[model samples]
Target: MEPRLDLLSTRAGGDLFTMLVSANNALAASPLPRATQELVKIRASQINGCGFCVDMHTKEAAHAGESPVRLNLIAAWREATVFTGAERAALELVEQGTRLADAAGGVTDEAWADAAEHYDEEQLAALVCQIALINAFNRLSVIVKRPAGSYRPGRYA
Candidate 1:
């Protein structure tokens, strides 16, 4: 399938892409565990219905040694046995954050408290940034109808 627009080809898109890449790099260098980052990225992508992102993050996670079992279970994380309490908390945050419109009050205090229990202030900051960044990327890709299955890990590195 062809994309509706080539985001990278336009000047405005090039600027936006640079900023997004910088944000992503900041999150990547944060205190949050790489595994948790991948899981969060995949989960947010899944929730946003961005196939391009889902494909990209899943492949990146696998390349970084994430097991197929865990990758496959992200969509059903609430019922899965393979995740840590911290990972589960992050996933919950991602869901609430991504689907903010569905919940009247946005992310609940309970969810924030749970995440606070698992992560320090700095890590929590990074986690929030990561979730927001992925959601933005998902919207961009989904809106553009970007095709999936061509991403290679480290392509932009």
Candidate 2:
């Protein structure tokens, strides 16, 4: 399918995306586990219905040797047995953070506490930022109807 807007072709879009990608790359320095980071992004993208991001992150996760079982089960993570407790906490944060309007008062204290239990302040900061960033990217992609299935792992890198 043709995109409604070629976000990379226009100078404004290009400039915006460059900054966005840079911000995304900077998160690589965070102490948060790479697997958790990728999982968070994938889950947030899925919640936001951003297929482009889902394709990109799932492939990137696989490229980094993430288990296919974990990748496939993210949507049903609550029922999956492949994730660690910490990973489950992060996934809960992603869902609550991504679907803020679904619940009143945004992310609940319970979810935040759950995440806090697994992550120190530094890692929690990264997780929150990751959630925000992925949601922003998701909105942009969904708004432009970004086509999926063509992304190469690290294409943004």
- The per-prediction CA RMSD against the true structure, in angstroms, equals 0.7, 0.7
Q: Candidate 1 versus the native: TM-score? A: 0.98
Q: Best candidate per lDDT, number?
A: 1
Per-residue CA lDDT of model 2 for 1-157, tens digit only, reads 7789999899999999999899888887888999999999999998888999999999999999999999999999999999999999999999999998999899999999999999999999999999999999999999999999999987888
lDDT of 1 by residue, 38-93 (tens): 99999999888999999999999999999999999999999999999999999999
Whole-model Cα lDDT of every candidate shown, in order: 0.94, 0.93
Model 2: per-residue Cα lDDT at residue 16 = 90
- The residue pairs found clashing in candidate 2 are none
* Cα misplacement distance, residue 9 of candidate 1 (Å): 0.7
Stretches of model 2 off by over 4 angstroms after superposition: none
lDDT of 1: 0.94
